[model samples]
Target: MCAVSDDVQISVRKMDMRYRHETLLKDLNFDVHTQDVFVIMGESGCGKSTLLRHMIGLTRPRHGDIFYQGKSFWHCGPEQREEMMQHFGVMYQNGALWTSMTLVENVALPLKQFTTLTRRKIKHAVEFKLALVGLDGYGDYYPAELSGGMRKRAAIARAMALDPKILFFDEPSAGLDPINSKRLDELLLELRDNFGATIVVVTHELDSIFSIANNSIFIEPKVKSIIGRGNPKKLLETTDNPKIIEFLTRGERYE
Candidate 1:
């Protein structure tokens, strides 16, 4: 585990994200400090995942920039972008693993492609990553062979295969039961505490929001911008915006 640094690790500056001709978020600005559990949240049509895509360099915004450690994400050269990607570990909402491949093969893919580690070393690294995610002996199993929560854990192990500095999660609790969801939250906190990873999660689950998010940006679809930013708990307690309050409490008034 690396020691925490108070540096600003990620900055979304005046970004305007879009889908085809329709604008999604405009002039969106936020900062992710090192080791912070930052969340992107809002309603169903709010483009939360779209914003994450921009941050991961999958989509180019129509305006403004995203910065990681002082480098412009959209303006960087391909090589630079490739270098930046080495610092990222993304776990999709579905736990996107190939059905044909075993968990071992899946996790080993990154180490095999990115590093020149020997066969034995790669195996050890894969084992270590799987173990880290509490999947110690499930290497030979396929995605279908595991339970839903186990599959998510396996996907997480794959994401950690390269030991990324920033971990991005998209709706991590979407399909899990409350118990499993809580387990994932604990694992995320463990990653932040143990590996010092800066976590950015795109989610609308109130349980997850309260459990994991230290800071967050609530995307308002109608307004096409962030409606709320700060600690999730504080926003839930004190925000005057009806949309934000409705979101935090699921349409119930905050008492």
Candidate 2:
């Protein structure tokens, strides 16, 4: 077991992933510090989402192990994995809220599944989570009744239901407008400041990256590996790699 540190919540070493003969990621290594907003950005098919899956244990690495709180999750038994998973909350690219369930019911599902709390207690907990995401009074609405941004907020509320230590968001602003995207970014900052939750976001949005990322990693498609890692502003100012420069100054002409 690796030594645990309050700052380093997740550590990945020499990780590799492949499907049959096609390699997706190679020699990947990174660490996510506690209460830090770590954004992973890359072009489509560069394996950003795949990396997120591996980090969250939805998929296992073909060659390397992932460590959570200094424990090797891939090498651990089912019970151990279960124990580790309880510390994580994941928000998918599409929000993934249940259409049939009301917002409150969706937020309360995780607690219901994992805890023995009474309905009243669960309701109270759910309300707290909804409030955290600025959805305090919309608990009775179903997914179909909410707007896109509202759906994303409701999804975030559900993800927080269990009070996870680490929150993973896959393209949290995928379908939202600029205004809503900024709101989500603000919510992320609030989450880190108020709850001290470590956030790992997988996004390619330039605005999102510049606005919220404290530290970031860039996956390069050609290398099928991480080409950059550091503060987004620092990387943008120093890196002359055409791709990195292009991505950093997405809408403006380089000349």
Candidate 3:
């Protein structure tokens, strides 16, 4: 575990999420601590990404509210909600970089939209962000020209453009080779260890769940709720839930 304090950065309280009038998750509750790499792990079709969408304000819950710093997100006014969202940075599964824009331009977009810095200052900031993600001289390259891993890193650089306090990633390792996935995991750890970022990642990758996560929640699709929570390794050793064990062990017998 990461020895985090009792500070809760994001809290999901009694949350119920649905798709097409079918409940996907009901009465969901969880807390993400400050500076912790919190992972949301589950099988496919478990609403892992759906819960993420709610956390990032892309969608509202059917029954409850999400709180950031103890302030209610769904109940807040638009201006306040926008202000709260400014503190979050999200990298979606597909990298989502604009194909027409160079890496510099893509990374610069957020700074340009959010800050009042001069063009010279924004250029400096953009370079610094790209370098932070190991894309130092590739700023001028288009997204299509880069490798899959590089494109994902570039997306991260853009996410960090405004230096958000909390970073949210949905299926970050979805399309990478094992080496690239490991490298990305290392980068995520670096961000948490060096920069004091509170990261929330939604992924089903077992390697990543064990390697990078200090805290986690496993969403059970059939039950439509979380069946397990806490450190992933500890959960593996202590949890008696067969479904959770099967998931953690890739459907193999744990004993």
Compare the candidates by lDDT and give the number of the best one. Answer: 3
Model 2, span 1-255: residue lDDT tens: 656576788888889987567898899988888888999998887888888888888888898788887889999898999889988999987789999999998999999999999999999999888887778899999999989888988888888888788999988888787776787899889888988899999988888899899899999978888899888999998887778888888837455
> Each candidate: what lDDT?
0.88, 0.87, 0.89
- State the displacement of the C-alpha of residue 60, model 3, in Å, after optimal TM-score superposition: 0.9
lDDT of 2: 0.87
Clash-forming residue pairs, model 3: none
How well does each candidate superpose onto the true structure, as a TM-score?
A: 0.92, 0.92, 0.92
Clash totals for all models, in order?
0, 0, 0
In model 1, the runs with Cα more than 4 Å from the true position are: 1-6
**Could you tell which candidate, 1 or 2, scores higher by lDDT?**
1
Q: At residue 138, what lDDT does model 2 achieve?
A: 96
Report lDDT (Cα) of residue 243, candidate 2. 84
Better of 1 and 3 by lDDT: 3
45-89 in candidate 1: lDDT tens per residue? Answer: 789899988999899999998889877888869899989988899
